[model samples]
Target: MWSEIIGKFKGMPSQEKVVRLLLERGFQVDGQGHVVSGRIEIPHTQIAREVGVDRRVVDATTEMILKDDILKRVFMNIHSIASFKDVAPLLGLGVIIITPDNAQNIGILNDVTSVISMFNLSIRQAVTDDPFFTDEPKMTVITNDVIPGELVSELRKLKSVKSVTIQ
Candidate 1:
């Protein structure tokens, strides 16, 4: 799905940078061609600076998105999410990072959570990096308390997990 979105900007790397940035940050293009995150307008200059492209490149990218029906539909509905991976430990929560053998494999989240549940630990949050955007995608699971050390061995037993680390 992401490849399809990015394929349209082939041969135009600068605009591609803009498109990647917009998708990365979940910034959407409005009908008026403004870059926004749920009603708040984002200046093209700021976007360009982030992606190391010219302001005009961001403008042109959004213009192209608005012109294409598929791109417009996608960008109009995309949104950002809040993750607790970084803040979990700071707030006395335990963090588990799992690097899967194959990110594309299904049921990894459910399987991991099931193992976590057996430990009787309550989950606070779970976030998985998009393989399309991340070079090495991993899953971050936050628990209300530190997980048992023995759980590590159990997690390693799962065929889907390549490695697991508790922080």
Candidate 2:
């Protein structure tokens, strides 16, 4: 999937430079002077220095990448794919409401417990809607073992969450 997106940029005249930039900084800079970070959380300054472009240029590139939803999705998918190798062994999925005041805390707790459970089972799919903000979004998860009935029950206890459904 990552290769396919990168291939899309191959026809561009700046394809080589873009590839080089992406390889060096995990993202490519466009003419609009935007910058994007790669899977490993790249710093803006590092990207700018490597691409031989100013920090402002790198910043612009980041904005450009964000403006294009399709491109942004591709970048995220590529990033997720690249990082999958590291998390492949963890057979667990997570779900959390975004509106909860303790969303972050809940998310962290979910991740930790999920990791622990992954050792005992296999994760099928994990999906979340706006897992960061307080916007009352839904989260979904599917796993081999249901990730312990108690944990889901606990998350549903939060005041900010409207409800919890498990299938």
Tens digits of per-residue lDDT for model 2 on 44-161? 6776576566666556545655576666664443322122322433544433222334443455436533543645655455545433222455545455553466756665565545
RMSD of candidates 1 onward, in order: 1.3, 13.5
Please name the candidate that would achieve the greatest TM-score relative to the true structure.
1
lDDT score, candidate 2, position 22: 58
Q: Which ranges of candidate 1 are over 4 A from the true structure?
A: none
- TM-scores of the models, in the order given: 0.94, 0.30
Candidate 1: tens digits of C-alpha lDDT, residues 41-127: 999999999989889998899899989999999999999888888888789999999999899999999889999999999988898
Score candidate 2 by TM-score against the native. 0.30
State the C-alpha lDDT per candidate: 0.91, 0.48
Off by over 4 Å in 2: 1-20, 23-40, 80-167
